[model samples]
Target: MPDHQQRIAYLLARYADKTCSREELDELFSAIGQGDGPEGLEQLLEEIWQARHPAPEIDYEAVYRQIKPAVPVRKTIPLKRIAIAASLLLLAGTAYWLLPSKRTGKQATVLIQPAQRRILPATNKAVLTLSDGTTVPLDSTGKQLIQQGNVAIRQQNGQLLYASQPTDGNIHYNKLTTPRGGQFRLVLPDGTKVWLNSASMLRYPTTFSGKERVVELDGQGYFEIAANAQQPFKVKVRDMEVLVLGTDFDVMAYGDENSVNTTLLTGSILVKEGSTKQLLQPGQQAVIDNQDHQLTVKTADIRKVTAWKNGMFVFNDMALPAILREVARWYDVDIVYKASPGAELYGGGIGRDLQLADVLALLEGNGFNHFGIEGRKVIVLP
Candidate 1:
């Protein structure tokens, strides 16, 4: 092998064995970005892949072409992000590159064949429960589900819409619950729009009848509240309350998470837990500790917080277990950890549309962990 090819091969070996230091990883990316000896490098990567998993046939030249054009030559890329990107290129039969642009950087994903299992991604699906204790299953089909008083409940284009007549004397409540591997969009009677993540539920009244338009959320939901200066919009999640007067925000109060995070994208919101209240401005986040109920404010990563709504999974130095927790919810699968995955953090963005096996392949390609699928369970192998 030539000197550059030998260096690249050596770096690949170290990367495969999980022994590459930060500088070495950067050097590896730099070497690849140099685009030296393309044919030799492609052959070398193919040989490595064939040696490990000989059953599959992959076009190394095509894969390399797909990757090389997308990888930005910037040296300022984070180590973990670059590592994950390169791992996807070599092991996952895909590549997710963070390409620099004039505005915010964008993610480019290239996928290949042999995604062994087809466990698909989440879609627009939920169950609606009426105040009269009746349940209605909702999907992407466009049709009127039922009528409650003067309000017409319909599911159209994967969204649940409540078209109401004039305020009747009677007020009823309805709940929309998204199962595992499911998500939904909702338009409340008061004109507020909500995007519910998987394994979440939202309960709201048929109309904004009282002094306040209050709704209850049990999991994650992004809200675009309609301006109602007289009757403020309030979101109740467990013991905490998000008070808003026409704003855009996201509330994540999942049971498995240790904190309730309320991120404000625009306007303002007052996050109150009991007597303690923290007012949040646009681009800020209020985090309430699940244990002690203490609240703290911090600058929010808007992209990461709203990635689900935007059809991406953006991780920034997130640990393996937490990442899998998200995976389990979206794929509607159980995760079994056979051995403890060490304190390795990952950073990148993957499309939420990919199948369970494809997502696992990208993660497992990082070389620190291996995954197996059995029935509806993803096993973390030692």
Candidate 2:
């Protein structure tokens, strides 16, 4: 840190938290001169100053000091010169950006780490209106069941619940929906847990009517079915049927609008659409094209696909639409594309708790596109 860069770093640290006034910030940034400066010993005073003050005044010395990567010890060299040499190790943004992100990025991962805290995006959400017309709000608030007569309609954790008696055979249906950018979880009566993706829905009878435990799903859900060899678990989506004796799998059956992807995590299951039958083993994902009556099987990365249920936001070679789709759902926000930057595959990690602003900044910083908030909606400025 040549004294100036150290000062700049101090200022950025303070300004980042809104501790610095506007004038102080502008002057601090101006000193960086494209975020680089000649590096040399910052003097014992600069180190002493930083230690005395947890956050010192903005100076170039601090800026240079902070960005520098560490160097290993070698034969005979003083520590002070080593420090300055290390500061020069810090690269310009372009150098840092060279690391791949499936797309080009303007900044390095270190520069992008702090921007994770974001403003939540605007998206639609739906509440379950029970048969009695009582609405159950869905959010992070855990498992809750609303009783209605002989039926127990509640949400266990993120999964929907229907604790209906076997002999009662009362025919009632419950709807599960995720608006544009919201997701939910529910536990079915047969001990089948479902994780609903955003902007999707599921409708099912409160009681098992036939000899099978059946449910109709409209969006996406991950199911951990309770094994019942005698009474199999059947998932009816659009017009397709997925029968499982006992398995842990995920189904992306959003009607005929999108491809139905059934990924089996464990156990064997059979997928059926009309007259066609497709058997799936662990790690296999069956993509069903309802419009064409076609089903295709391929290897899948289940962690990236099923991370939503576990409160993780994962993207592995996912296109922009697919990545943003998950972000929109968890953050519960509407996405208005500012421009059309499509089909670019993205790979990285972010949290479900991130605000819309942070997520947008991440995308923009990482070379996807820029975004802004219009009132509550997230306007993706392509």
Q: For residue 82, what is the lDDT in candidate 1?
A: 38
Among the numbered candidates, top TM-score falls to 1
Evaluated at residue 139, the lDDT of candidate 2 is 65
lDDT of 1 at 257: 90
TM-score to native of every candidate shown: 0.73, 0.65
- Give the number of the best model, judged by lDDT: 1
The CA lDDT of each predicted structure is: 0.77, 0.61
Q: How far is candidate 1 from the true structure (C-alpha RMSD, Å)?
A: 9.1
Candidate 2: global Cα-lDDT? 0.61
